[model samples]
Target: MSKKVIYGIFDDEEILLNSVKEVRSNGIVIKEVYSPFPIHGLDHVLGLKRTRLAIAAFIYGAIGCVTAIWLTYYIMILDWPMNIGGKPSFAYYLSMPAFVPVIFEMTVLFSAHLMVITYLFKCKLFPGQKSSSPDPRTTDDRFLIEIESDDEKKISSILNKTGVTEINVKEIS
Candidate 1:
């Protein structure tokens, strides 16, 4: 049997919320939601869990910090021990100001890059991956809801109840 997904298109936030409510009330499961802009309280309406990006970012930042400290200490103390202007080679305590820039840059670099990679991986958006978005216009001025089901009658009923502006169906091969 072919897997089917019902896509609903909307132009307004209120109508989107109402449509979600109606579809959910009918015991239909929403596969995904796409929106052009952030809609207030829409995540709550869809019962979506909050993203853990902040936590991941913190962990990545910590990794960056450790890497920076290790690299700086190894280079300054062991590899190339250079004393500039009578300053101690391992003057980490006194030369913290100089190291701050490196640490900050590494932290930002690691957090930003790692967070993006993790987010993309978690969202199943790997390189050369194709997503099944029915309407490209949903990325601009429309909202799209994808519901997984093969019951056309139930899908049509739900769409009618939710006042969906446009509807389409796609089969996953």
Candidate 2:
């Protein structure tokens, strides 16, 4: 099935922002907006919910911390029991200070790498994926707003008053 949508283009971020607000106020549902650079507060205006990536990062960090602690305990205390530098090898706590750096590094490494992977997966940005942008100019200096509406005349009238640079209609599946 294919749906017809209206695309409104703007040259300035400010104009796009204001136009978005006005369009929302008029009860038209905006499908998406594309811009070359992020415009602050656009997400808030779009009424998007906060992300849970931070929670995922914390969980990944905890996993790394636990893995590092287990590895250090198994290697230095249980398996080899090294007596290097005359450090106490009798108890894990006695040798914990030496393991602090490794633990911290592991935690940071897991959090950073896992978070990036999670983000890429969440965004569906796989290799060889085609772009979803409606207009090429939106990748440079233009802002494009997509609204799904079968009623073109009504949407065009509302968008025209918003001072759009150009308008185009497209059908998508």
Candidate 3:
């Protein structure tokens, strides 16, 4: 069935939070919430699952470290080895300390860049990506809660009682 969404626009974070709780407690399904700033405890109220970005970051960092080790070993110890500062160029263990900075920097670089890319991809955001927020005010000073249900009467009653300043109803494809 094509769903009709109701957006309860709120003027304050506290009111939005309270309204979310009230609506959900009454057996209504909230599709999404938009806010100008982060709302503390909102995730808990929404029952969102924990993110796995940390695990992905760790794997990216491991890959970077391994790449750094192989590149350093191949260049410094095998391919045209240089007698840098009169240090032994034949043994990688002897030049291990010199490669520590490179390894650390590569690890941080790979993790940060890859993690951000992954986040952007997961969110379906890229250059020139069109936004989906129905009201532009949700990105500025307002908080919006989108509710999905077939009962318009119940939805309006709940939203009106919960201090919603503006309400917009739309059937989106």
Cα-based lDDT for every prediction: 0.84, 0.91, 0.90
* Candidate that beats the other on lDDT, 2 or 3, i.e. the better one: 2
Candidate number of the best lDDT: 2
lDDT leaderboard ranking: 2, 3, 1
Cα lDDT of model 2 by residue, 30-119, tens digit: 999999998999998888888999999999999999999999999999998977877758889989999999999999999999999999
lDDT of 3 by residue, 78-125 (tens): 887987677769799988899999999999999999999999999899
TM-score of every prediction relative to native: 0.83, 0.93, 0.93
Residue 62 in model 1: shift from native, Å?
0.7
lDDT of 1 by residue, 1-173 (tens): 67788888888878999888888877888988899888898888888989999999999999998899878877877688788898877766666677888988998899999999999888899879975667789778999998888786788777777778888887877
lDDT of 3: 0.90
Best by TM-score: 2
Candidate 1, poorest ten consecutive residues by summed lDDT: 88-97
Clashing pairs in 3: none
Give all candidate RMSDs, comma-separated. Answer: 2.6, 1.8, 1.7
Regions more than 4 Å wrong, model 1:
1-4, 170-173
Q: How are the candidates ranked when ordered by TM-score, highest leading?
A: 2, 3, 1
